[model samples]
Target: MGTFLGHLLPGSFFILYASWHMFSVFTKYFLSQRALATTRDQGGTGSSGGGGSPSTPYYRSTCAHVFPCCPRIPMEGIVKIVLTTIGFLGELITAFEDGVFVHYGNAQHMTMYFAFGLSGVFDIKVSRGPRPALPNLDYVALAMAFAMEALLFGYHLHGRTPLDVQVHMLMLYTIMLCAVATIVEMAYRRSVLPALMRAFFVMLQGTWFVQIGSILYEPLTSPWDENSHSQMMLATVLFCWHCMGIFLLMAFVGWLLNSRVKRMLGTSSVYCQLERRLEKGSATCQEALQLTEE
Candidate 1:
């Protein structure tokens, strides 16, 4: 994945994937919190719960809700499978040298995509198949996928410039964290923290991948000094910057979703109250009319 387009394409995919995960996680968390608050206001015992509530039930994202006839279709899994297949094919075509599979680096890249594609298949099976052998098998699949990714990237830096090696090494940290966080998420499927951490690391990795591409290729500016210690240190500092930026982005997304959810809940509450008041007024009018008839 050393080529300019190579890094950019995968990096772009990761950014979009991470953004989707973050959006789903934040929206569900906020919806659950809103439900709990409504329960409290209605004088019910509102315990801090981890799993989904009726107001925002847990289900893997699919287009089934939009098209009821296709309830069994796992859209997310399909997308993963299709896109990763295309990516895998692309790598295969490029890695070949006169009928020889000599590009070891591209082979490593292919494995990463293959792992994710297999995870997609697991998603489909779990969603469509009868009672999977293990509960949360999807999470396990995802965790393994991330672990595979980290393992491959860990060995991908051979015969590289000092700067390239340093930048990729920094990327390895995020990938390892992503694997760890995903494993934790499998255990705490209901809790938002682990999922949020996973999303954050994914986003960080995505942005860092793009950053690596820019630094090494200098598509927009002069090329970086691959041998300078100062340049290497700068890359490290820049990685920290990417972390802070992703954190802020996540925070903003969470806050924005929470506010919107609160507004929706408030609007629904007002509408319900209005209906109740109208019902009461209509009942009193009926009683008065009966008395007049008497």
Candidate 2:
């Protein structure tokens, strides 16, 4: 799995972030009250009958879509729609540019993760599990992930020719995205604020992966280059592991968000079971209180 995924690290990161973005819209709408949801504009896609296209076609397409059958579509959908569109645009944008970063150095990569460590403390919102704060384990995991992004870039720079400048720059962006995601993960662990902010960033990471695959398997470059063949391979291995970690992190966040929304809604039968358990505990406490009185 690592071998195949090693070929696809950055791509996994972007896709997972996109998936997270997709879910957040549903989450907000699902959690809203009916009357308030109705009063708000449905999506900006002519659903409100403002101007552009006819309301019937927009509603037709929207109704044609699923998931928001009961609640209105989130206005946030407009932003998400735009983000997803832009994420794809990165591929084209990178293609037009020289496709390499100018100037690379070890010092530059280290600052990336430092930013993440700092950001985590500020963007705290907990939308997951029983806790109001992100789990301690999440901080540990994020710090570790941040280290991996930096370390890999360190190796990449160490092997560079002056020509690798643009490539290093892309690596820098990957480092920055991972750094932001790591901090966001910490903040997320603290409380599920807006993973959506760093969510679109996965695309730039995917650009890294596709580039790696080109070097390894693509006809353009050899898997082994002279300056740091062995070290580069090690970087590849780490890159793949990091991507898997990235995917798992996204999935875990999704699970955390799901659990949180479930608990918030209290609609699930399992939630009822938990409520009953809580009531039983309350009764036990009350009996103890009565016995003390007696």
1-294 per-residue lDDT for model 1 (tens digits) = 766778888888889888877876666456545645665576543332344212212222211111122333666678789989999999999998899988888888899999999888877776667757677677778878888888888888888889988998888888889889888877765577887888899888888988988998888979999999999999999998988988999999998988887778463453232222220112232231122111
The lDDT of each candidate is: 0.70, 0.40
Off by over 4 Å in 2: 1-5, 17-21, 24-136, 163-165, 181-193, 215-294
Q: In TM-score terms, which candidate is top?
A: 1
| TM-score quality measure for candidate 2 | 0.36
Off by over 4 Å in 1: 45-72, 265-294
Which residue pairs in model 1 clash with each other?
none
Per-prediction count of colliding residue pairs?
0, 15
lDDT of 1: 0.70
Considering every candidate listed, which one attains the maximal lDDT? 1
Native-to-model Cα distance after best TM-score fit, residue 190 in candidate 1, in Å: 2.7
